[model samples]
Target: MDAVRPLPDFLVKRYQGWKATTYADNRGWYKRLAEEGQRPRAMVISCCDSRVHVTSIFGADQGEFFIHRNIANLVPPYEPDGDHHGTSAAIEYAVTSLRVGHLIVLGHSGCGGVEGCYQMCEGRAPHLEEKTSFVGRWMDILRPGYERLAAGNEADRMRALEKASVMVSLENLLTFPFVTKAVEDGLLTLHGLWTHIGEGGLETYDPAAGGFVAV
Candidate 1:
């Protein structure tokens, strides 16, 4: 506590002033969001990493989007019962209840989960109970991607793994009954996106092109 930095009084006062200055627009914003009840047209599937915030990247405010986040932003192949379907539940809620028109799988660079998969394959990490380390289990989803990438040169393998993971997630998204129904009915469109944290580059899935193209 003694070594902790204290807030600058000037900055604190400035923050207080900022509220009053921006009050006109913000005063009813929360209430408006509550009343509107998140009529978002799009649902974003993104990583749970602290660094990758979908709302901040999209410049979206409350009720603007429905979002689901998980390790590597993965959409697991739908399997009923036993397993908790956090991402699927969100997807079902968004697609069925909210009727979102778009579902985006947002991938990013330097992903810890992706890296963990690589490490796990190399026998660098093992399951440790009560530790919450996912190197062993989470990597199961990316096993195919890792194998495909490992067949290539080191540099290419990394890039391929990241891209392939996104592709796999897209495929998995289809396993959900609601998602499949929505897509079949032409009520929903699925997209894959790769984001570079440092460069801020965006690559969007182009089904016609059969690859991710810059967007």
Candidate 2:
């Protein structure tokens, strides 16, 4: 694999400038927050795409959200298999430890991870062996959704696959004991959300309606 280098010169210099400006604008607020620790109301699981930044998308400031990211914004089915359960550990901390009031699984259109699922379903990506591709394993949770949504036109099928993927992930969330307990006790709620990156629209999943509606 090729070694990744630092950010481009322009981005590095621009971020340096922004850092100083932010410090000047919120020095006192930052210090107070650092001392007090965080009490964010929500936890968000989103994609690791460079274009999909949680704080910027929500206009959140420091200490607003406890966020986690994975390919395709997926949450694996609860399996305490090994030491490298990064996403699971984050979910445990955010829900059980932090006691966040809401946990949102944020999925988006034009997601590369979701697209990868499409390729796998069609047998297009030969390099994706079941054991090696973490993407393959993580995304397997969405396979049933893809199968159910397989009847429509190519465009419609993609849309269905994307939306169904979110629903499947929501189901996976309930498999986690802490998340299930939180829901049962009425202390926490889970939501599935879809974002239209191209047009900047937010559609939330509605189980009763069986669709994504504007929220």
How much is 49 displaced in model 2, in angstroms? 1.8
lDDT of model 2 at residue 56?
A: 79
lDDT of each: 0.82, 0.85
lDDT of 1 by residue, 145-169 (tens): 7776647665566676778789888
Error of 2 at 12 (Å): 3.7
lDDT of 2 by residue, 130-177 (tens): 778877877777788788875767778887777777788888889999
- Candidate 1 Cα outliers beyond 4 Å, as residue runs: 1-24, 127-135
State the displacement of the C-alpha of residue 91, model 2, in Å, after optimal TM-score superposition: 0.4
